[model samples]
Target: MTLGRSAGGVRLQDVADLAGVSMKTVSNVVHDYEHVSEAMRDKVQAAIDALGYRPNLTARRLATGKTGMIALAIPEIDQFYFAELGRHIGEEAARYGYRILVEQTLNDVEAERAVIRDRDEGLVDGVIFQPARIDTLEIARLRPGTPLVLLGEAARPVNTDHVMIDNTRAARDGVEMLLGRGRRRIAFLATVHGDITESTHLRLLGYQEALLAAGVGLDAHLVLQSEGFGFEDGVRAISSAIAAGVEFDAVLCRDDLFAMAALRGLEIAGRRVPEDVAVLGWDDTAVARYSTPALSSVSPDKQALASAAFALLEDRMQGYDGSGRHEIVAHSIIERATT
Candidate 1:
């Protein structure tokens, strides 16, 4: 005299049997499909709780060709903008009933390739590729027939889907803000020059355009290009520029972290912000809101970018055979005492 089955394994059938529902209905509930009636779903969920059942994500993926998991690839997690973006993206994916996998590439070419290849070989359902080095082999691995969304960074030829803020416009507006405050001798602190990605070129173009419109010449001396994007690099760039006796009325950093190092260097030299030289940075991170004088920078809606990324990726996974799409999120400048 025993019951029909024991609930030790917590399989789909356990919930189905206990709830007296079809396995398909159970699948729909677990997958968060829209069609399952609330009353029926409630019964299934109650049984699932009683049995402590967990959906077999692997098997479900096998049957439906979906893992309910997506990947995000980036250079590092320390940068405030990237870190903030990562957090928002995670929340957005969870909102859509998807799990996230993160891959750190350290901005190296080979490491980026390895991660993309791993994702392509069944490790993940789709990816949000943030290209560090867009080489052919790497591009080939990430060229998504599966869902793929590109994040903001350097640019590459788009035969794929992407979502990002208007980086060029953001930069241009930052420079224009500085100019509007009656600062003409403005400097552009770049992490790199002549890069294939249009991020650098476009932002620089904005700087030039703004300068020319204001009757200011684009001086090569004011362009401080760093080999890397880091605090120490910023320190070195400022120190080197000072040694070369380059003169400028203001410094605009590509990122706020670099702006910090620039500010530090200037402070040690007894120069007051906006009094001796005005300073501006991009990507309004936590540092921007709480720095010494508080930083004034533009904020690109990271959550909007994330939402766009996942939506497009999910569509692609559902066999979306559409052309590549791109989204340029709106950005607004935040004014603080530093400006």
Candidate 2:
């Protein structure tokens, strides 16, 4: 006999009956038990699809004490980099039957603190955080009573898992590549220049290291600071340098957006690329390849970063009480017309 809870309501028993399995077996399949045989799982899944069964999340969480939801906090969702990161993380979480709640911190310290101090407990199983302006000391003091995975170089070696690329090394390699093209007077176009963040600091260190290694004198004038990380900022930085008679044969922009802008600015100034000045950028975003003159960039392993972050968060949720984990994904340079 088929058990019916109410009209148009499908219960667990319905699935079990459809799959010709016991209720316990249906529950095992629903909960993703590892020991379930492949054939059995397939049969149960087929039954579920036929019946369109969906477990009640509230009941599941109440019984399991897990919300099956994680929060992803980044600076902004509109920005291409963060948007791409969010999409990857959301897809990854979905693979494990979890959902990701995305939040924008706007790179503000107070906003980041608010996210850390979220009052709703168990609303999310954990957090994958990318802090922009919050200091490490402040982050160390927060009582975020949940699992956390740090997504970038900031807030490192904290009481959480960290996934990142070697910013310093990548930056150094970018400069070295420019140097190899016989470009000595390389300008560093950076965002957040005066109050440097961890990423900016590391990239600058790498730039200086490359210069010193190549026996090139570091010209203070060659380092241009910008208030923003955008095309206009790149244009302004390069244009201002030109107006000031600051001689430079190349530019190492902090990101692809800036590099594309620098290219336009250089073109407007009647400078030829490769022949007169070469440009390099980091992040190797999609737009880099299609820019007017394809931009050379530092391509970090973004897929690896997302995978590692999800793994760390899952381990934490599974009650792994080990010390903080730090994983650095690899990066490489993509050569193009600019350099």
Candidate 3:
């Protein structure tokens, strides 16, 4: 029997009939119920493909009281690390039959609070937040019972799930790589004025730790502070350091964008990469691989981070009432042409 594309097109019952299975079985397959056999799933999926069947998401949401949508809030989507991480998180969310609704918080406190507020309104099933400005206490106060997975180097709330790499250890390894190459005059870049963020504090601590271990005193002048964490911020910071007669044979940046900018700034200052100034970056973003002389970087396992964060969020969504579970994903240094 041929199914015609009419008023509502193909239905679930139509797909079941075509697959020679009960409607319940088709429903199970559509919902990705684990108890369904692979053979039955394949049969139902084949019929679904043949008829171009689409599940009624509105009806499902109404029946289950879940929107099957996840909210991902980040400081900036344009930043290389966050952008790459979002892509990975999106792919991981799809594996669980969910779509992502991204909210760019831009490190604004109000914007970050809005994401938690929206989740309370039942707009999305849960939230994956990477907060930059707000602290853990405020997040805990705002999200009393919402399913939240905190990302990045922010202090994790007491009872909220969190996922991140060990920033201090990763930074130490990156700097140690430079030290192993006989680079003593290393400049730690990407410091900001005022209250330091957790990420910057940890990375800088690691930088100092490595220098101290090598018996090299941390020079106050070699630590270049930036106005912000943007590409231009890096460029200006490095250029100003050069113009001000800062002497350094190596530079370790907080992120890939800064490292790439340092490359340009150094070139403008007539310093050859590796030969005159070795540069290292964090995040190991795609740009790191293609930058001039390539960027040696600290590579965090982004896929593992997404997987762990989603797993925690999924557990929370499924009524897991345990305390906050903090997961530390793996990271390593990628020594490229720059070092």
CA lDDT, every model vs. true structure: 0.77, 0.84, 0.87
Estimate, for each residue in 1-339, the C-alpha lDDT of model 2 and write its tens digit.
123221347888898999999988988888899999999999999998998887777766766788778999998898766777788888889998898888898888888988778725678988999998876677767856788888877787557688999999999999998888889999988655555368878888999999999999999998887767767877887888898999999988878888888888898899999679898988888788888788898888777888899999899889997878889999999999988
Q: At residue 52, give the lDDT of candidate 1.
A: 83
Report the C-alpha lDDT of model 1 over 148-216, residue by residue, as the tens digit.
777865644456777777777787788889988888888887756334455666677778887887788
TM-score leader: 3
**Which wins on TM-score, candidate 1 or candidate 3?**
3
TM, every model: 0.88, 0.93, 0.94
- Clash pairs, model 3 backbone: none
Model 1: CA > 4 A from native: 1-8, 17-23, 49-51, 135-142, 191-198
Clashing pairs in 2: none
**Ranking of models by TM-score:** 3, 2, 1
The segments of candidate 2 whose C-alpha lies over 4 angstroms from its true place after superposition are: 1-8, 191-196
* TM-score of candidate 3 relative to the true fold: 0.94
lDDT of 1 at 99: 85
Tens digits of per-residue lDDT for model 3 on 7-108? Answer: 357887898889999988987887788999898899999999998887776666765788789999998898888999999999999998899999998778
